[model samples]
Structures are given as C-alpha cells and as structure tokens.
Target: MNNSKNESVGCIVNECKFHSMGENYCTLNKIQVTKHETTAKDVQCTDCGSFVKR
Candidate 1:
C-alpha cells in the first residue's frame, strides 16, 4: 500500500492497510463505508468496509 496520504480522507486505524503510514489519514482517494445492522443508529453500527488487516 502507498504510504502517501490522501488529504480528503482522514483515518486513524493503524491496523488497516489503507491507513497512511505514521499518520491519521488514508492513502486511497476514497473508502467504502458499511453498516453492520440493517439500520445504523450510532457510530458503532457503521464500519469502514475498505479496511484491510496489515
């Protein structure tokens, strides 16, 4: 994965492969957001679908 950060996207998940190296940002131009439940009611119900384990 590219270590370069995408200014438009901010990410803090260090475990994710898309997370910018050494920064709270994303390397991809865009990311996919998914909901764990049929109707998301809070932040916990949502997830970054683009996340990949490093």
Candidate 2:
C-alpha cells in the first residue's frame, strides 16, 4: 500500500486501498467521481470510482 498521501485529495474512507495510511487523504494522484443518480442532489449521489476494497 502506498502510504504517500495526495494532499489535494481529501478522503476519510479507511477501507479504501488508496486511502492514506493514518491520514484522511487519498494516495492516488487523481480519482474518478461517478454519478449514480439522474440528478446531482448531494454527496451521497456520487461515488469514488477509484475505490478498491482494502
């Protein structure tokens, strides 16, 4: 696992493989934001497509 965190990417999902070790950030240089709903209502309607089970 890459413990190096991308300062620009803020994340709190500890279960994600790209999540920074011991920090609330993402290790990936970039991430995919996917929309699951027809209308962009709120945060819950979107997902981090780059997420991988740790």
Candidate 3:
C-alpha cells in the first residue's frame, strides 16, 4: 500500500491473488485499495487467465 494519496487511487488485480471478485475495498491498507479490480476495464491475468470484474 502507498502512503501518498495520489499514488493510491484504487486497487489493481495485478497485485492481488483474488481479484476475480469486484471487491476493491482496502482492508489490508487504510489508504490503499488492496490491489483489486476497481473499474470495468478488462485485464488479462496470465496466471489464472480469469476475467476480473470491476
């Protein structure tokens, strides 16, 4: 998680193991979004090849 507000806009699936869920709430970090999907943008996960829901 980033301390700077500007650096922490939201979570990104690339940083999370469970990003298939549309939940991006940052429980791990107060300022960060926990590295999960936060938008409808499509991202290709090479490890799982699963579509992330934003």
Ranking according to TM-score, highest score first:
1, 2, 3
lDDT leader: 2
Model 1, 1-54: lDDT tens digits are 566999899988989888887879999887899999999999999999999998
Question: lDDT at 2 for candidate 3?
Answer: 32
Mind giving the per-residue lDDT tens digits that candidate 3 earns over 1-54? 232223233445535443423455222323322323544244432223332333
Name the best candidate (by TM-score). Answer: 1
lDDT of 2 by residue, 1-54 (tens): 456999999999999999897989999988999999999799999999999999
lDDT of each: 0.89, 0.91, 0.35
Q: State candidate 2's TM-score.
A: 0.85
Candidates ranked by lDDT = 2, 1, 3
lDDT of 1: 0.89
Over the full model, what C-alpha lDDT does candidate 3 score relative to the true structure?
0.35
